[model samples]
Target chain A: EAGVTQSPTHLIKTRGQQATLRCSPISGHTSVYWYQQALGLGLQFLLWYDEGEERNRGNFPPRFSGRQFPNYSSELNVNALELEDSALYLCASSRRGNLNYGYTFGSGTRLTVV
Target chain B: QKEVEQDPGPLSVPEGAIVSLNCTYSNSAFQYFMWYRQYSRKGPELLMYTYSSGNKEDGRFTAQVDKSSKYISLFIRDSQPSDSATYLCAMNGVGYGQNFVFGPGTRLSVLP
Candidate 1:
C-alpha cells in the first residue's frame, strides 16, 4: 500500500512569516497526528486530529495549529514563525482504534525559517 | 525528567557486531512500546512494537520491555553499515494517555 504522503518536501520562510505544511494519510486511515523534530529535540507532538476534530495537542504555543480535512488529510500552520521553528514536521496517520501499528508516517516537510 | 529518556549515542561498531540500545521511561502506565529507526533527514520507520513487557524478535532485531523497571531494549545482531541510523523509542498508554511519547534518540554507526 502507498504510505503517507506530504507536500512541499522543503520550505523556506522568513521570520514572522507563516508556514503551512500538508499531509495525506493512508487510504483507509482516519486519525492524523503532527510532530516537530527539531535538532537536539526529538519528536515533539504538535496536534492530533480524529474524524475532523482536534483531539489533543502538545505543549507548543497556540501559533502552532492545524486541521484535518474530511478525507483524513491534515495541514499544519505555524504563524509568526521564528528561527527556532525551523524543523522537520512529520505527519502520521492511524486507523481510529488501531493506534498500535497504524502510525504510518510520511518522510516529512523540512521548514527552514530565516 | 522527560517521559522517555535514551542515550544519544553516536556509537560506532564494526560490521557483524551485535548492537544494543535502551530507553527508560518515567511513566509506568504506558503499555505500548515501540522502536523506530530513522535515517538522516528522513522520517522514522517502526521496527518493533510490543504490548506490555516481553521480548519480540524480528530477523536481526529484538525488542524487550520490562515494566517493573520501566526499561526497554532493542538488540540488533550481525549489524551492517546499513543499520547505522538514529533509533528512537516511543510509548503510549491506553485510553486517556494514548498519545505517543518519544525519546531523544540514539544514533548508531556501524562501520563497514
Candidate 2:
C-alpha cells in the first residue's frame, strides 16, 4: 500500500500571495481531509471531502479552501496568505463511511509564508 | 476549554523503562479513541485504535479507553530509542465525515 502522498514537501511563499498544496490518497480511499499543524497548536481541522463533495469544514476562514477530485486527490488553496498560514498542511484519507479504523495521514506540506 | 486535553510533556525515560501517556477529552460523545506516533518531520502514524471503552493490546503497545472518566491511555513497554517521538491522542464520534479531535501531543525521548 502506498499510503497518502503529498507534493511540494517544502514551500515558501510571500505574504499576501496564494499557495496551493496537493495530496493523493491511497488506493480505494474515498474520503479526504485537510488539517493545519502550527507550532504548539496541535492539529486544526481545515476541510473534509467525500465522493467529490465538500462535506464539512472547520473554523478556518473562507480564505482557506480546498477541493477533492473524482480520483480522491485533494488540493488545499490559501488566498491572501498571512504569516500565520505558514504551518504544515496535512492531508489524510480513509475508506468511505468508515471512522473506526482512523485515517491514514500524509507526511504533509510544510508551507512557509515569508 | 479545548475538546481534548493532554500534557505537552517532553518526557525523558530510560530505554528499557515503561512509558505511559494519557489524554482527557471533554466530549463524552466521542466513541472511537486512537493514538498516533509522529516523528519530528514526518506525519503521524496510527499506533492504536479502541472503540468505546476497554483495553486493546498489540505486542509492546497497549491502548486503554475509559469512557466513564473521559480519559484514555497509551502504554509502551520496554521502550526503545526508536520510540522517541511525539504521541498524539485523537477521538471522534459516529459521524461519517466528522473530524477527529486531536491533543497537542506529548514528546517522548528514550535515552540510551
Candidate 3:
C-alpha cells in the first residue's frame, strides 16, 4: 500500500504571511494529525482531525488552524507566520481515533519563514 | 518538567555494538509507548510500539517499557552505520484521541 504523502515538500514565506501545508493520509485511514518540529525541538502537536471533524488541538495559537477534507486529506495553515515558524511540519494518519493504533507519518513540508 | 523527557545525545558508537536509547515520561496514565526513527530532514518512521510494560523483540531491535518508573527503552543489537538517526519516544493515554507526547529526539551515530 502507498504510504502517507505530503505536497509542496518545501515552502518559503515571510513574516506576516501565511503558510499552507497539505497532506494525504494513507488510504482507508480516517484520522489525520499535524505536528511541528522546530530546530532542536521535539515534535509538537498542532491539530487532530477525524472523520472531517476537529477532534483536538495542541497549545498552539488560534492562527494555526486546519481542516480535513472529505477524502481524509488535511491542510495546515499558519497565519501571521514568524521566523520561528520556520520548521518541518509533519502530518500523520491512523486507521482509527485510538492512539494505540499507531500512526504513519508523511515526509513533511519544510517551511522556511524568512 | 516536560511531559516526556529524553536525552538529546549525539551518541556515537561503533558498528556491531549494542546501542540503547531511552525516555522518561511524567504522565503515568500513558499506557501506549512508541519509538520513531527520523533521518536528517525527514519525518519520523515508527520503529517499535508497545501497549504495556514488557519487552517486545523484533529482529535486532528490542523495546522495553517499565510502567513503575515511567521509563521506556529501545535496544539495538549488532548496530550498523545505517542505524544512525534521531530516535524519538512518544506516548499516549487511554482516552479517546489522546495526544501523543513526543520527547526531544536522541541522535545516534553508528560508525563503521
Candidate 4:
C-alpha cells in the first residue's frame, strides 16, 4: 500500500509571494491533514479536510489555507509568505471518523521563504 | 503553557542500552496517545498508539500512558543504531475531526 505522497519536495519563494503545496492521500483514505514543522517548533496542525470539506483548522492565520479534492488529494496555499513561513509542510492521511488510529505522513514539502 | 511538553534531548546511548522517552500533557481530555519516529528529512512514522492509560508492548518497544498524571512514555530495549531518530509524542481527544497536539520531539542517537 502506498503511503501519503507530497509534491515539490523543496520550494523556494520570495517574501510577499504565494506558495502552493500539494498532497495525495493513500488509497481508500478519506481524511487529509496539513501541518507545519518549523525549526525547533514541533508539528503544528494547519488544516483538516474530510470528504472535500474543511473540518478543522489550527491557530494559524487565514493566509494559511487549503482544500481537499474529490479524490482525497489536498492543496495548501500560503499567501504573502514571510520569512517566518519557511518550514516543512507535511501532509497526513487517515481513515475518516477514526481518531483512535494514528495517521500516515508524507515526506513533506520543504518551503523556504527568502 | 503548551498542551504537551517533552524534553528535546539529543541523547546518545550505546547500541545495546535501553532508551526511555517521555512526554507530559496538560489537557486531561486527551484520550489517545501515540509515539512517532522520524528520520532526517522524512515524515514521522507512527511507532505506537494507546488509548486512555495502560501499557502496550510491541517487540522491543513498550508504550505506557498514565491518565492521572497526564504522562506518556516509550521504552526501547536493546536499542540499535537503526533507532537513531527523533521520537515525537502526539495526543488528541475523542472527537472525530480533532487535531493532535505534538511534542517538540527527542532526538536519539545510538552508537554501534
Candidate 5:
C-alpha cells in the first residue's frame, strides 16, 4: 500500500510571506495531521483534521492553520512567515481518529524562511 | 514541567551493541505510548506502540512503559547501521482526536 505523500519536497519563502504545504493520505485513511519540526525543537503538533472538519489543534497561533479537503488530503498554511517559521512541515494520517491507531507520515516539506 | 522530557543525545554506538533510549513524562493521564524513528530529511516512522504500563517486543525492538514512574523506554537489540536515526517518544490519553505529545528526540548513530 502507498504511504502518505507530500508535495514540493522543499520550499523557500521570504519573511512576511506565506507558505503552503500539501499532503495526501494513504488510501482508506480519513484523518490528517500537520506538525512542525524545527531544528533541535523536535516535532510540534500543528493541526488535526478528520472527515473534513477541524478536529483539534496544538498551541500554534492562528497564523498556522490548515484544512482537510473532502478527499482526505490536507494543506498546511503558515501566514506571514517569520524566520522562526522555517522548519520541516510533516503530515501524517491514521486509520482512525484515536491516537492508539498509530500514524503514517509522509516525507515532509522542508520550508526555509529567508 | 514539559509534558515529555527526553535527553537529546547524539549517542554513538558500535554495531551489534545493545541500545537503550528513554523518556520521562509528567502527565499521569497519558495512557498510550509510542516510539517513532526519523531518518535524515524524512518524516518520523512509527516504531512501536504500547498501552498502560507494560512491555511489548517486536523482533529487534522492545518498548517498555512505567506509569508509576512516568518513564518509557525503547531498546534496540543487536543494533545495526540501518538503525541510525532520531527516536521520539509520544503519549496520549484515551480521548479521540487527542494530540500525541512528543518529546525532543534522541539521535542515535550505530556505527558499523
Candidate 6:
C-alpha cells in the first residue's frame, strides 16, 4: 500500500511570511496528525485532525494551525513565521478507533525560515 | 521533569555487535509502548510495539516494557550498517484523545 504523502519536500520562507504544508493520508486512514522536528528539539506534536474536525493541538502558538479535508488529507498553516520555526514538519495518518496501531508517517516537508 | 527521559547517545558499534537502547517515562498512565527508527532527514518508521508490560521480538529487533518501573528497552542483535539511524521511544495512555509522547532520539552508527 502506498504510504502517506507530503508535498513540497523543501520550502524556504522569510520571517513574518506565511507558510502552508500539505499532507495526504493513506487510502483508508481517517486521522491525520502534524509534528515538528527541530534540531536539538525532538519531534513535537502540532495538531490532530479526525473526520475533518480539529481534535487536539500542542503547545504551539495560534499561528500554527491546520485543517483536515473530507478526503482525510490535511494542511498546516504557519503565519508570521520566525527563524525558530524552521524545521522538518511531519504528517502522519492512522485509522480511526485504533490508536493502538501506531501512525504511518510521510517523509515530511523541510521548512527553512530566514 | 519531562514525561519521558532517554539518553541521546551517538553510540558507535562494529557490525555484528549487539545494541541496546532504552527510555524511561514518568507517566504511569501510559500503557502502549513503541520504538521508531528514523533515518537522517526522513520520517520515523515503527519498529516494535507492545500494548503492556512484556517483550516482543521481530527478526533482529526486540522490545521490552516494564510498567512497574516505567521503563522500556529495544535490543538489536547482530547489528548491521543499515541499522544506523536515530531511535525514538513513544508511549501514550489508553484513553481517547491521549497523544503519543516521544523521546529525544538516540543516534546509532554501525561500522563495517
**Tens digit per residue, CA lDDT, model 3, A1-114:** 998899899999989999889999999999999999998878999999999999999999999999999999999999999899998999999977555557899999999989
Score chain A of model 5 by TM-score against the reference chain A: 0.96
Model 4 over residues B18-110: C-alpha lDDT tens digits? 999999988888998999999999999999999989999999999999999989999999999999999999998856346788999999999
Clashes of 4: 0
Which one wins on DockQ? 4
Candidate 2 residues lying further than 4 Å off, grouped into runs, are B94-96
RMSD of each: 1.0, 1.0, 1.1, 1.0, 1.2, 1.0
lDDT of 5 by residue, B4-81 (tens): 999899999999999999999987888889999999988999999999999999999999999999999999999999
How does the DockQ of candidate 5 come out?
Answer: 0.79
Q: Which residue pairs clash within candidate 2? A: none
Chain A superposition TM-score, candidate 2: 0.98
Q: Where does model 4 sit among the CAPRI classes?
A: high
lDDT value, residue B17 of candidate 6: 98
Determine the iRMS, in angstroms, of model 4: 0.9
Cα distance off (Å), candidate 5, residue B71: 0.5
Indicate the worst ten consecutive residues by lDDT in candidate 3 chain B.
Answer: B92-101
lDDT of 3 at B82: 94
- What is residue B23's positional error in candidate 5, in angstroms? 0.4
User: Per-residue alpha-carbon lDDT of model 1 for A63-86, expressed as tens digits?
Assistant: 999999898899999999999999
- Position B75, candidate 4: lDDT: 98
lDDT per residue (tens digit) for residues B1-112 in model 3 = 8999998898999999999999998888899999999999788999999998999999999999999999999999999999999999999886635579899999999999
User: What's chain A's TM-score in each predicted model?
Assistant: 0.97, 0.98, 0.96, 0.98, 0.96, 0.98
Query: What is the TM-score (0 to 1) of candidate 4?
Result: 0.98
Two-way TM-score contest, 5 vs 6, winner? 6
Model 6 per-residue lDDT tens digits across residues A30-107: 999999999978889999999999999999999999999998999999999999999999999999768777988899
Candidate 5: list runs displaced more than 4 Å. B94-96
TM-score per model over all chains? 0.98, 0.98, 0.97, 0.98, 0.97, 0.98
Lowest lDDT block of 10, candidate 5 chain A: A94-103
